[model samples]
Target: MGIGEGEPHPAGSGSSSVEVVDVLRRGELVVLGRIPSASNATLVCDVVLDDVELRCVYKPVRGEVPLWDFPDGTLAGREVASYLISDALGWGVIPETVLRDGPVGFGMVQRWVDTPDNTDRPHPSAPSELPDGRVDLVDLCPPGAVPVGYRAVLRAFDSIGEPVVLVHADDPRLQRMAVLDVILNNADRKGGHVLEGLDGGVYGIDHGICLHSEDKLRTVLWGWAGETVPAHLVADLADLARRLESPDDDLRSDLAEHITGDEIDALALRTLVIAETTAMPLPPGHRPIPWPPF
Candidate 1:
């Protein structure tokens, strides 16, 4: 049968979460092209179902290069697990994802989110140090441009040696995603992995290097460090901790199918610590942010 043989709207259309999962699990995958910049081999594809056409990214097991830290042939599985964690917490930060046999072999297939234009929003201008020996906003306005009190948390230089301010994690969407990264123990939460959808939803992706048993939570979202975690978020973490320890929980069983038992236990431990502290984690000091920020 031809791809998307019976669709009026694209893949998601108005489908429920269950329907979306079903389509991702059983739809026809048509590879459109390769995403060359990804560390692992990644493909942009169309998931064609009887009544929907969904854009997706496909990462096959065979395409993964060996990593000394994480087990071989398990990155795709981690990607699916990340989606499950995001869903369980009701954060809605990760796109719908599933694992199935594709053209290359068993791998991860995730819904592709489209980023909307954010030209009207404030963006980074430049960075400078403060009198207190801390780095923060120097100025945001361009020459005579109107100032909006945008604080610069991090700083980097542009292609021609001009400075560019970095994103402040104070943005609500970003703050949520950053907390999710801490829960997942994401070791590679790059700026590019954060997506702003056309519907104004923000999502985090590229979770292949996450959920380690060790304390490897390196990221670019340090703006909330040393701050109190909101009480509601603490409650959510408590719920997650309970779910991780429950024997009959579906999410626990699902994660076991993809990752090691030790890693799951580590997740439980991490959840408890986060809830107990109720504060953003402090940097480990010495090279916490990933290189090539974007």
Candidate 2:
């Protein structure tokens, strides 16, 4: 969880903290403590921020082969991946990379996911025996996905009187969140990508694939294929759209720069769909399942 693996070292680890701009990305850097790579990337620390409490997940200059089958180096889509899940969950779950002081310019800071009460990786011999109806928060899929094995969890939600509308239709808050997520090009919202937090909250992690300026809405939520968007969310979508189009919209511009031109069009289209509550598919040629398939 140290800095300066890639970027020039401004100060050594033992140096007194300096201005985040000079040392961190901005003010409000909460050193939540350091951690090690649990899944992918070489990130070894977790930090929190002011306001949105964006978890700064700094992607260090380290990774292994076989992830996404890249076979070498690291995958380039992690930032967008975290964006998708954070938006879907209606909470801030992005790579702490917003900070500029960390080595590699601060994309994600590792937050420690304490060992679960039941911390056994699913048996390799009988993987499906993870229990068909079990409520294990983290599905034991190889490549991490947070949304894939949601049905079992959804069933538990149903037991608690939560409705089981398609992933996109279950919650209006989630629908609105999706609007923001799509605009951000969050790519890794797979079933295992999401983390059910200790605070009764769901926080999405793994952001190396975020902010890509593309129209990538692949997740299990597409089950509600033709559902209409709710009205309250439509108004919210309008507000966000207006803000994104504004000249002062730093977030939008940041995204527009990273993603593809067609991706920007996809973001605009998704926003319009949410604003109008269009009962249509999320995007043409868009995947219906989150990646890192569970």
Candidate 3:
């Protein structure tokens, strides 16, 4: 139930909520003291039972719905997939608890993850340094530690790995992740949210904006356009694409029980979107970045 040093939390595993959004149906929790609604969807608090070491996420009634719109109370089905993936890959996924009764109908509560070394703590989307230059301040989602960062992840998918982000056209792993994001319609791929594990793995966060009926990818990675696809890597993506559409692949939605029929359709559509356009130019008039910074 608790995480210790040198061990990563398991995927699709985390504390669950004892309540839903309807109870507070008309309001929010004010007991979490001076919580900020400005930076990161969460404002740091001691809502969950734990010391400064436990990872905790605060939901402000209005903050919960975005994590995965599952009618308000039930844990998000889509997010659990991310949890499973992150856990399987080995990293923090920030387990959640919802507090209800507000605009969005739910808020989150979970453990607090440590900020990576030589860097500031991270918000759900952007990683930022603390005010006093100390390490423990509530910070934004931090960026990856390039060169040394993702070394493990890159090595895992080495046959298809490219030296850069945007130009990694042939990277099957990234392509698969991209496909997953497209299917889920994830919009919080901001630099800080994506982490390069100390063990060289790749992990991401912020599932609130996922599973939309449209393309919502808005991250700050990918160095350029028209990046070339490595043929071998493309073969891997083609395999995943094929596997995704296969109805027999129960494992596809297994880890995450919150997924719906429509969400599945959205996932298939993601592959189509990419297949139709290899370059996949940014759609017109979309800022791609979420407002309010939270």
Choose the strongest candidate by lDDT.
1
Alpha carbon lDDT of residue 14, candidate 3?
A: 29
- Which one wins by TM-score: 1 or 3? 1
Model 2 C-alpha lDDT per residue in residues 142-240, reported as the tens digit of each score:
222335434222222233555442232244333444444454455555655544444444544554444444445555434334666555555656665
For model 3 the local lDDT of residue 195 reads 42
lDDT string, candidate 1, 236-263, tens digits: 8999999999989998999999888999
TM-score of 3: 0.49
Q: In lDDT terms, how accurate is model 1?
A: 0.79
Better of 1 and 3 by lDDT: 1
Off by over 4 Å in 1: 1-8, 117-151, 158-161
Candidates by lDDT, descending order:
1, 2, 3
TM-score for every candidate vs. truth?
0.85, 0.53, 0.49
Runs in model 3 deviating more than 4 A are 1-75, 83-180, 229-233, 253-256, 275-277, 292-294
**Model 2: lDDT to the true structure:** 0.42
Q: Comparing candidate 1 with candidate 2, which one achieves the higher lDDT?
A: 1
Q: At residue 87, give the lDDT of candidate 1.
A: 90
